[model samples]
Target: MQCMNWKLSDIASVLAVEVVGNPEALIQRVITDSRIASTGDLFVALVGERANGHDFIASVIEQGAVALLLTQAPKQPVSVPYLLVEDPVTAMQQLAAAWRLKHQLNPVVLITGSNGKTSVKEMVRAGLSARDGTGVLATQGNLNNHLGVPMTLLSLRDEHASAVIEVGANHVNEIAQLGPLAAPSVAVITSIGRAHVGEFGSLDNIKRGKGEIWQALPATGGVAIVPVVEADSEFDGWSFWQDALAKHHVIAFGDMANLNVNRGWQAWVGVVERQATTEGQLVRLATSDWGEATLELPIAGAHQANNCAAVVAVLLASGLSWQSIQTGLSEAKLPGGRLRLLTPLPDLLIIDDTYNANASSMKAAIGVLMEQSAKTHAFVMGPMGELGDESQALHEQVVDFACEAGVNAFLASGSLSRSLVQRFDVQRPLADLAVASEDAQRLAEALWQVYQQKGSMAVLVKGSRSARMERVVEALVKLASQSAN
Candidate 1:
């Protein structure tokens, strides 16, 4: 694909910025980091929580950046062209919108939810790319937030046959802002759960935030793929979603047979059957729209069934044949740091799901680890962040389920780990539990000892982003390597 170019003067007019040096300079790329800037790239100076991009203006200019997008006038004289605006971040979003409008992309899919957003986005990309002559682009990694969404949109080139963008927000009105910028042809809400309950205050508020994606759809027409929520779910009375999205086509995918059918509503009822395999598991998905098909998913977790189903719904709505959808699902792979299995030793297995966590994901990871037939099953976890007042209670519930599942040990770390360790009095009879002293390597050593004792062991490591539970996965691999040597 050829690089997308925007004239400095055109970008300034779009962003309402004043051009300083060469207004005619052509910007072929947009980059935020000075370390990654190339010739003809427009360096956007973003003020972030930890670092300020303005601090590296000279560095990026020296590295051949043709122009700069700045929030303020440069402190030092620079030979490169530049544009000054009120806010570089907002300017970046406006610039991306201008580019998206210029390209007029079709079948752009915007996905958001408390969980499964990334997985569903990746799955959709896989399904789209499986079609002959289709070029697909997606948000790289967890770049689903405000700034990241703009970058993803701006990265879209003319060659893309489809684009799958992940829209993420923790608080109210956040998705509302991103939705218009994306203006997706299809909007997908994978599921609403307690991912950031602390920020939103309640699940109802989260539903309001997630529903903003559908609200962003053009009044002309669009498609919305949402899960058929159960009666006991926190989002039971989300019928308002239909009213808000009345102008659009809405499709529902889930296990429920009695899905609330609203005006212009189409539903794909499906059920998942899981069977254990030595590598991962086999999932048989029987859906009303596409009929029955079994897939060998290399990743472990029952939640994957829902994620795949959401992908299938979107692909089918996009008018792809069921044969292509099946081929795509068979080739789907979860991004790293999710429920990925690692066999560092012949007798040891690690279910590394350290990408991020919450109440729902924690239980799902434990379920996958329990699928193992190892003599000892252990869970290494950290605190689920953004849970505010209920953090302690949620931690307690996690341990309770871990014990009820008959795991041999619950190896935990983080600020909330103490909650599980303190409950050992009642848990000791059911299983062993301990909290690490904030040292991941030390925790890995203790877990390694537990695994060594049992002839075969399977360990599930998971936590929120702040907890960096992936460190434990790394530590275990390092220790296993040292022992082998």
Candidate 2:
């Protein structure tokens, strides 16, 4: 959309491919799928483990794709412009680099970690916008994997001053491929947690995957910002944290370091102690640059403070003034379905955080429920996925936290969560604990019945993506709407 039209030769030179077709062929757009190919668009046929893009070449060209970048020769020769490369994925990365240089855009910031990447990206976008009113582009959702990263960069426009790309990986070497394409001027590792530890095998592998963000930093003096972790935490092995400190610069925040939550507001004021290479921590008083002088966030959670802290670090690192940061923070809202508060009913408040769930996020949501002044707190929880061997243990841990947090009514859905509820009953007698059958609909209906009988209550709905917790949210909202009618 930013008036991108590069010569075939230019792209060929960047990708180091032999241009065998029309040298003057103009490519205004880049696409991976044949169904979505448009006129004058360059279709990059990447070969995946399951299917090869070369198989779709003829179909894509038939759909008005002007050119193709292929890893292998086409079986049937179509008189279309083409570039033959050893690897189309690598070639796409090369094209992304060339496009960035050609547009002269602001430095890209690459963000990755086991948790909080999306939140950090949003914060960076907000902070950067406050500083310069520059056109900013960020990943739409959790589109931070290998295919998602290139697609995000390809969506960039010449008018955009900067881009914040979120990278997620479940295995090793994933971030290594994404780093060069993003070409981050600054890299931020949000935190290392057991997000996909099952796929990676161990915590060390998880650290190795997250550390790729730092490894991708350009040797030309790039900065890395890492949050301060406990001395005993495994995150100390973060190469990005050490590498930036050794060569360029590193900024650290968090851990009871003169931080305060702005009362009745979303904004915060704190003195961030600048940790010099030699000096440990030195105080620099700073106020958030974005949002109301005092504001409240739409989403409720204690971990939000940590998420906000990471955002604060990104804004400060980006050179935004304190006032701008405050303004931006005030303006920021939670991404949809991440602790989204539905309208208050006469007797209940609905919390729809069903987008996804994990150990840390579950604790944060429960903490928010604990702080609310409700006669009773009800939770409709589903299983958390991808924890590998720790799935059952993690579920039990959440149940223990819930019992300790004083949730009055706990409705566990999903077989795994039901198993956790049973374990909790054996370990600690929870008076109001109910385990629903496999049907999420039946669970929602039962919860609605209880809410109708009770005069006042609060509800939290949460689960992994596969659990479709949003459906439960919809059912509850529908019940409330019908009652009003």
Candidate 3:
């Protein structure tokens, strides 16, 4: 994407700054890191938790940055054009909003939640692109944090009619900072769960933080696509929908309810019942939007149905016809390592959900294994992190859930996971489970042997980001490749 030419005056008004130096200095790009500063780029010096961007001003200038946006006036100002704002972080957000308006592109959709945000974003993108000459831009990987949000906005191009940006935060105010940067024409909150429960302290704080997406919606008129999760219901009275109604105007896609999974992973949904299935229920879904189609999704577990529901709502809100939405969803593919199915060896089915795991996601993975009627299901679950003080209890609870779900064989990794081994012995009459050290490499070698011997069993591998569960997935893939040849 070619960078647009920007002037000091264009950015200064949005930032409410008094341009100091040459106002005519042309900025062709905006950058935050001094290392990437290039000729004609505007270096935005933001204050972060670890370091202040203002400290890198000299280096940014040395690298050919034409302008700077800083919170405080530099002790020794340089000849380069710069804008002094009270808070560079806020200034960056305002500037992004202004830049978005200046481009006159299609509407932007912002997605946020503790879980399933990325998947829903992709679903919406697919649904929208199936119709019109839609160009979809989304948050790459997990760059959903404060710094990541603005960087995603800066990556937008003229061809993009709309963007699906994911917003994530562990503390208060993080989402607030990201809200305006994307300036979504429609905002979607997937669901509020126990993510970052340590920092947020209670579920209440998580709800409040997620609510920031609603507060960020532009008043000129916008749609808020909120899943009818229990926590989200609390804010229903104060949502943007009410504000839109007061103007004697309503968005065409407002308040989509009901979703039913039809013949395959396909679903039929109405706006009202859409929020009802936010928890868990596997039902045949048909929708007026996507007429008479059935979809059995490639991904496992019933929770995915809920995630799909959110995607459906976002697509409908974006004005996609039922046929296009159904086609896009039917063609949707899962991300690598996110419940990716490796080649089957003999009767063995390997499920690699090792990308990341939390309690809720873990349960979903286990559920998939339990549903395989004819196969003995084995689970290799590594430690799920960020549970804070509830880590032990939560890990133990997983062991209990696994037993109840009828998981035939269980392997626990990590120091915290060892607790599962201990609980399994006491909870079950026979201690059939194995405990691997926190080292994933060693666990991978051992799991391969188990797979070779237990030829007919289905195996599931899962863990948190820090656990490196991909090592196990790689081992399985290698074994499958060798067997095929």
Candidate 4:
């Protein structure tokens, strides 16, 4: 938050609100939570299920907020200007959209998809920051929603050369509506899978919802980075084909041979070839924008192949040299719980892909688990959520996938876990379990007991956000640490 380049009048105009106090007051910062309210901050009162920002009005005034933007002004006025709007949340979003355009956070990359949104966002941020040799504004944590997008934009300062905003949606039209607030120069969809099929209704609906990002791009001079698919029929079939006729540039990634783009558009293609390495893999990417180069993808996992390719396309589109892309990605730190490797004992390797889960991601984790050399390989997970009517079948597919991948043991917890155990192709886990979360000692003891049965073992743990699976990993690691001591 470099001092906001805004005044009460400017915000009022953008938000279609009327100022109730000094219109000339300048805003140095904008905050929703009154707890963080301080001098020069424009505190916008928003309504949430748990609490209402309006409740904190007096507290914000006491803390010296320069102004207030709320649907209703407080009964007692204080030492601050106030902008009364129909809705302060909408007002804040209006300000964010306007601010992003004014600041010129060039090439604001908006990433959305079923999986790999965070990893790709991190990679793009690291790649761009490395390429530019400066700090870049990227989404912090998993704040990638309606409120999160606006908040992310408002955090941008003059120093940032670029911004990577992760846009997420549980249902249709969520990403579509976030476009103006994001003011993205580029938009990329990582992949569409069954992660949130419940809210989206079906895969085709998911395609339409995710494809809305492209529509959010500026009609002219915008860029759409999409994974190459066998067919674009699902993206509103004829409508998506007509999109190829639109003015924006399309950069297709993945197996380019499978995607056809001969529709009189300036289409750019990026291809990825991967060779496995111990820590990660060497990605050989060739793109129409920057020609050809091979870089070591810092993250591990065979499933990361398409993600690496998509990042390369983005980096290439941003005009980054291969050197910066390689170096920056090497230094890039992904947010926790995505294929994180842990060695509690010499023979026991733990793969934590617990960031979030869907059928595709779980299958991918199983692929990674199979690559490990341990005699005993266990996959521990909770039931995947938001899978809609197909949840039961999808859960069974996990068991089938593990079997096909030749996994040695399966350990899971959730209502569906027991049923999953019934379909396993390999031996069941050595120990019974209860959910351990936030590093509960009992959970660690249960997980550790399984590794006790194997001379050398590798375990993969994953679950959806609802599963709180990282706690399982933490508990096991803590128990391992205590055992080592």
Give me the candidate number with maximum TM-score: 1
Clashes of each: 0, 18, 23, 0
Q: List residue ranges in candidate 2 displaced over 4 A.
A: 46-59, 75-79, 132-134, 234-244, 257-299, 344-346, 427-430
- How does each model score on lDDT? 0.80, 0.71, 0.69, 0.77
Q: What would the per-residue lDDT of candidate 2 be over residues 3-55, giving only the tens digit for each residue?
A: 46777877888876678888888888888877898788899997779888889
Q: Estimate each model's TM-score.
A: 0.94, 0.86, 0.80, 0.92
Reference-based lDDT, residue 386, model 4:
89
lDDT of 4 by residue, 1-485 (tens): 36775788988888776788799998888888888888888888888899988888888878888888877768775778787788666776788888888777667899998888998998998898885666589999988987888988898888888899999998888888886578788888888777789888988788788888876787787877776665654432325435543767777776656544543335555545677788788877766646788888767776687788888778877777789888888987677788888897888898988888989899988888887888777788677888889999998887787766777666677777656766663344432332323333555565678677656778898888778888878888887888889
Higher-ranked by lDDT: 1 or 4: 1
lDDT over C-alpha atoms for residue 300 of model 3:
51
Relative to the true structure, candidate 4 reaches a TM of 0.92
lDDT of 3 by residue, 109-187 (tens): 7888777777777777777777644577778888787667777787776777778888988877778778877777777
Candidate 1, residue 31: the lDDT equals: 89
After TM-score superposition, the amount by which residue 386's alpha carbon in candidate 2 deviates from its true location, in angstroms, is: 2.0
Runs in model 4 lying further than 4 Å from the true structure: 232-245, 256-272, 425-443
Clash-forming residue pairs, model 4:
none
For the record, the alpha-carbon RMSD of candidate 3 to the native fold, in angstroms, is 5.8
For model 1, what is the alpha-carbon lDDT of residue 244? 72
